[model samples]
Target: MKITIAYIEEPPFGWTGRDQAAMGADIELADVVLRAIGVSTIHHHLTSFDELLPGIQEGRWDMNVPLFVTPERAQRVAFSVPVWSIGDGFLLHCGNPKVLTSYEAVAARSDARLGIIAGQVQFESAKSAGVLDRQIVLFKDQPDAISALRAGMIDAYASTAVGNRVLAESADNAALEAVAHNNGGDGRVPIGAFSFNKSNHDLIKAVNKRLIEYLGSADHRARMERYGLTHTEIDGAIISQSAKY
Candidate 1:
């Protein structure tokens, strides 16, 4: 059998590498799980982030992996039990003068402008933390958002912790840093999951069963670490699934 998976660019989760191959922890994991379930051929389709859900709904793709699940999204697509939970963070100048590490901090400032990729959980989280829509400056992708932050066009760039870390570590960005979101409480930690067309109930179940097995393995741990995820984070994510959701 064969399957087509759609995704947008988000490092450590999913992206088109320099060689134009779909590569990331989530992409590789999906490949492994699909092959294990007798999917001999897998196709990766790159779509605009804004199009992922609508594309899935229209059957433009068989599925979408690397979506950060929320109640709103779950209502639209069938989500497999989350592979892990991760939170948003900020990529800021070296000094982080405004200390915009968490959404709450940005929300607290009337003058603060935060750059976020359009249609991402970071945008949702910012709103949840009381950020007004006017204060948000949506960019088309991470590079654009990062550029805005670097050029002082935005106070900070909001995105995933792993993504920010990867960006800040780049040679050209030596003056920036990645700061994890810790707002004195659980402030909008999103569970990451693959989304399937709502009608693919059997396929969702099959993938979820295989995913759970894969998540429990040492191979998963190594794959995650390669993308800068800490063991504690994934472990807590698994436990939180049962405890909170």
Candidate 2:
């Protein structure tokens, strides 16, 4: 049977429009899973990240690709196994002209605008750090926040380190640079793998079985490396899922 995979333009995670060939680590690895299972798929790139789940709910798509499943989201949708993991990152102007790294630095510079997804962990970190509300501008997606930063509407964008690297290195994002604060895995900032549904229990099991086979393989490691997702401070498949929601 042919499965329709609903994906976004999120780089390294589910890149399609980024390259003419629709190539990405997730896509590449997913190809292996589909081929092994004799399952055919037609990739449908959604207009926006917000559309990912809605499409699934609407029955317009059967799969959501490379999505990070937080505990809260798991309630609304059935997630398949997480395709991979990521670390939080800070995207700043070149040279980090502000020399900003941690939340403390951001809070100290009241003049600087901190861009973050409203309900994301980054915003929670800023909140916990005592960063004032005015200093934080909520965004719908990582790319939007990055665009705002480039446009000078905001001073910095916070997201998974993987996103920071993708945005900073994207030919379109020449002015930005990724700042890795060594925060991943630490108690301060924790991230984890993507999530899929128990709703598709069979599919999830099949994916997990395939993933298990790929675990120590060179190809699996190489594909992930290409996505800029090096070793991360990710929480467990189930535990971190609970906290982020």
Candidate 3:
């Protein structure tokens, strides 16, 4: 059957907007993998990260692509074996400006403005950390937040580790730098797989099996590196943690 893939339309992932043309690492990886298994005719596009959960919960879409299998989310949806592990951390403007490092550091500063993704787990993390509701500026999506960051509207941004590399490297802002989590950043955030309904167990298992094959291949590592995944252990954690399955 044709898979209607739902993903957040953003760079180094997949998005169809001005400036950015088509698929990124995740988009291409998903398409290639699914088609290899004879699931051709992929209709892929972007959806807000929050909207994916709502849409899938309501059956508005068949899958949420490039997903990370969080225990909380896994309890409600069927997730394929992870296809990628995305590490995330802080992205700050070029230069050692402010010498910013950790979220707590940003929080301690009264002048700091944090750019966060609304309805995302990171937002919850910030909230749990007591990020003042006012100090936290919520954006509709990642790219929107990045734009604000480049404009110097925000002090620093909490972002996926890979996102930091891409924005710093490819994005217009060449000065952006990704400070690894150990330097007071969150070690990494994992991103992979799609969330299918529990009824799609067959699909889920098939995807997992394919993941085993894919991950073992050198090509997969190349793909991950392209997307900014440096932590190999994340791949193991993604599958092992799914024991809750």
Candidate 4:
């Protein structure tokens, strides 16, 4: 069997490597689960965030790299078991001149501006935290948002805390910093999972079963660690799934 999976350039999760191969935590996880399920070949389709759901829904791909699960998104695609749980954070200029540590903090200041990728859950999260549309700027991808930040077009860029940390560490100038979301003391983090077309029940079931058996294993933990994920994120997925049952 062969499968095609869609992925976006979101580091620590998915990205196009120097050799033009899809590489990252989610990509590797998908490969393992698919191969274990008897898939003989896998195709990695590179796409933008806005296209991930629509592409899968249209059968343009068999599945997508793990993306944050939301009820609105679940309505469009079948999601596998949760793979990772992560919280939001800000990628700001080093020294954080605006002192923007949280969505609420960005909203509280009239002059504060926040950057988010178009069609991402972060936009909704920012809106829920009282950030006005006027204070928010949308970009097509991470590089554009990071460029806007470096150019002083936006005060902060919102994404997963782990991803932002990776970006900050890899940046050439060391000019960026990542600040984990405050969560307002609620400690609620979002969980992500591979998504398939609603009609692909057989494939979804197989992948979910394999994922349940694989996640949090010593080998899985070691592989994920290479992408900057620790047991905190990996085990959180298991814990979150347990709570649901």
lDDT at position 46, candidate 4 = 95
Error of 2 at 188 (Å): 8.3
The worst-scoring run of ten residues by lDDT in candidate 3 lies at: 180-189
Name the best candidate (by lDDT). Answer: 4
lDDT of 1 by residue, 1-245 (tens): 88999977877678899899999878988998999888989999988888989998888888897678778888888888778777668888998898786788888998899998888878877899999999999998776887788889998888877778887887989989999877456443667888989998878888978877777579888888888777765775677556744
Task: Give the candidate order by descending TM-score.
Answer: 4, 1, 3, 2
Cα lDDT tens digits, model 3, 1-245, are: 78777888555666675754456766776776777677967777467887887777777776777666677887777777666555546778878487667666666777788888876666666666666778889898888888888898987778666667677787477778877455235444455666877776666676667666666467766765666554463465455546534
Residue 181, candidate 4: Cα error in Å is 0.9
Candidate 2 vs candidate 4: the TM-score winner is: 4
User: How would you encode candidate 4's per-residue C-alpha lDDT over 205-226 as one tens digit per residue?
Assistant: 9998899899999999999999
Best by TM-score: 4
Which residue pairs clash in candidate 4?
A: none
Better of 1 and 3 by lDDT: 1
- Can you list the residue pairs that collide in candidate 1? none
Question: Which ranges in model 4 have alpha carbons more than 4 Å from their true place?
Answer: none
Please, what's the RMSD in Å of model 1?
2.0
Residue-by-residue lDDT tens digits, candidate 2, 1-245? 67666555567666555355566666676667766766776564554666766666666766666655566767767755444455566889999888778787888998978998755667777888788999999987766887789888988887777778876887888878998656645544443333443356666667667755664366766666777755442223334434433
